[model samples]
Target: MTTTATPLALADVALRLRPGDHVAVATRELRRGTQVALPAADGGLVVTLPLTVPRGHKLAVRAAGAGEPVLKYGQSIGRATRDIAPGDHVHSHNLGMDDADRAYEFGTARVALPPAAVERTFRGYRRADGRWGTRNYIGIVTSVNCSASTARLIADQFRGRVLDAYPHVDGVVALTHDTGCGLVPTSDGAQVTRRTLRGYASHPNMAGLLVVGLGCEMLPVDGLLDGLALAPGTPVRRLVIQETGGIRATVRAGVAAIEEMLPAIDALRREEAPASALVLGLNCGGSDGYSGITANPALGRASDLLVAQGGTSVLAETPEVFGAEHLLLRRAVSREVGQRLLDRLDWWKGYTAAGGGTMDNNPSPGNKAGGLTTILEKSLGAVAKAGTAELVAVKEYAEPVTERGLVFMDTPGYDPVSVTGIVAGGATVVVFTTGRGSVLGCKPSPSIKVATNTETYERMREDMDLDAGRIVTGTATVEEIGEELFERVLAVASGEQTVSEELDLGSDEFVPWQLGAVT
Candidate 1:
């Protein structure tokens, strides 16, 4: 919008919007006294109304008209739901897009990707069964809270010994959580527990795994095995802290077991494999106005390329995609996938409402500070992280994504919880986009951080790996960045260290979603 202020007005010059946008996310901090230009009839429709909006507050998107609702993201982020005047700030009080069991226009928005995938390859650790890995580590997974420390001690034994011995074996990691005990064996918690435990034990990235548990826990080690379809005790090793005599005895025996397993684990080597075997996880956090315009679309391009190569990718953060669900439904491969996605969304609405949270609670304070004002706006930008691939399947949270194409997994918008579900669902690599800077990682599966802008990347050089912000800076196009992201994924999958790995991140981020009543 054109400004009327004198020749040299330069106060917190934030995003100056044009007529097409509905909301403006704060790229820079805004103070109460900040003066901005408003839409004037004489200046024509190109002028966007401006107000002195605080960092996370919404301002009137020009006085609303009787039939005119404030638009966000160049689309109907929501509606006025009531007559509004121009220059009146818009927010939850005035606008509402309470979508309930809404049907979407599908097959109308399918983006035809460029003919085929670019020829790209990476040095990946090819498994005996031909699966590829970003890192080869021995997982010491705890099935009960009692064995948590024991698992840590077992993993710690190989931390920093003068080791030319197990160079190929990445550091052993203990995957533990606070649950897995104190629950009914037939309950959902038990089922969730079993799924998570088995997902790790048989995860493609783990070269070998040692299942640890306290024999007396309700969700005992043997019960967990019954739920999984593994060949036998041959592929994995197990230890019960109690049966091994004591902590000291268990640690000693665990070390011996790992010593025996290391040589065999090290025997696996990297080789050529089809990119289709790759299952990419689409994630976004610390977003900004530039996220959708830059990194997200770029990620979409990369996703489509992967799908074309016969690979699979998953788009998660279900609540984050609330407003943009229609966009995806339009691209659903079948009506069933679309309906299943809608069913999950319906469940979330009821669940959130019963919990006293409105959909408006979706856009985090950080998201609002970044220019997203409503769930609709935030969702639109968030889905961009998936890139434009066909909507093949939509699974419940943490459900393994076996379909070899682009799919969506239902998850809460929280970064760690969402990524954990994706990882647990069998994604070996994650490509996360950030504009405000999210320092995150998911191990066993390596994450590649792509910065949406040069500024954030420069500010946190040590944390971000690729500068997807280059797209906004004009250093590269989304296609180029997408290609770069694809290459980086393969590199990380093949064992190249992501920035998070190099900095020893991802260790504390192994949080599995605990889905049970807090009783």
Candidate 2:
């Protein structure tokens, strides 16, 4: 079962992510009885498949008794529910979730990264509040769903030619969500809504902002301002439809306010800034088996590079990182940081249970169809986006990320919601990894989409910003691709438009994490 040969070629069409992994991923559909060549330390070994193995699916590389641990990435992804022979398809049918004991030692593997060779800088807007922004846009924020349409109409007026004179200001964007009404103002949901709105209203990327409201909703413009503590003299305007006489009147008023502020917003200019000013949001969605093997790890390397440069990277999606939290705990800067992460996990366990769901109830239908068997397998891959940096701090959802290195924010696994929290936390740039081809974008912060495999990258080239699939195809190494991504991040931060931004994809993706009953 072992050999001393060099690792198999990337062209072999199959891969074992780690030396101790008992299962290997199929790069392409494997037919029954087909001999698959597996690289071993001593020499090459061949296994004949007993069943068809679809692309991205796993094949058992060694025999496992019923209830035995199934190993991948050199870690136990799950346990076998039935005896599995070598070459058998390993999936949900024969695999089941199990809670295994993990050794949680804080700061055991913490290492200070060496500074990068090149001192990189990007052109960014330096705000008076001492925050750097990649984009200078006028944000029109709605306090309640009742004013969502009015906000859109106001922004629509400036959509194309209206903002032609304001060359320094990015297009006006209306950030509207479905909540903000139909819930008690004192409830958790209301607090979350208000906090999220406040974050956007005072975001660094917004040179100026206009708050729109229907006047009587539980979440009001004035209430949001009261909680936000916005600095005096900051450029902000407010309008309420109920107070402005009606919808048309409010739209006109909102447009007038933005017009009055345009000259000042357009006065802001981009200046050269160090990479330390960059706060990158690490995200992944529509993931598949190739995720861990390719894009996620490559993104992790890029994150490590960012940390080396004194920049901050934020890894989110709390439930998505459930089973893999132990790996992060070991990198925690202190016991307190590790405990904070564990606290969030404990909260999620109760949150999901109370909803009659389990943490393993993930790997959405799309994930399963893409060959992900369980949340454990997905989580191990998802955390790769964090790289190996020490976890400096863990913050609650929508909280600003103050630490300079890698940090984690507690957020739901949903792409839109998770990214929204990240952007609200002051991320000026985002690198999103995806295997199933997600066309997502976020305003204020531009999003860079990386595809995990060549097929998806080619199919979605119009939307994907980079191709990490080259790592899997042997065209490039992880470090090389990571360096390439790092360069791209700087370019995007320096006023280059991303594919998503060019396509105007961020308008509908603004969703805040709602935590209480909707009623």
Backbone clashes counted, model 1 = 24
Which residue window of length 10 is worst by lDDT in model 1? 7-16
The lDDT values for all models are 0.74, 0.88
User: What tens digits encode model 1's per-residue C-alpha lDDT throughout 340-436?
Assistant: 9889988888988998987668767776566555687678777876777778899877787889888899888889888888888889899999978
- Which candidate's TM-score is highest? 2
Model 2: residues with Cα > 4 Å off, grouped in runs = 1-11, 39-45, 227-233
lDDT of 1: 0.74
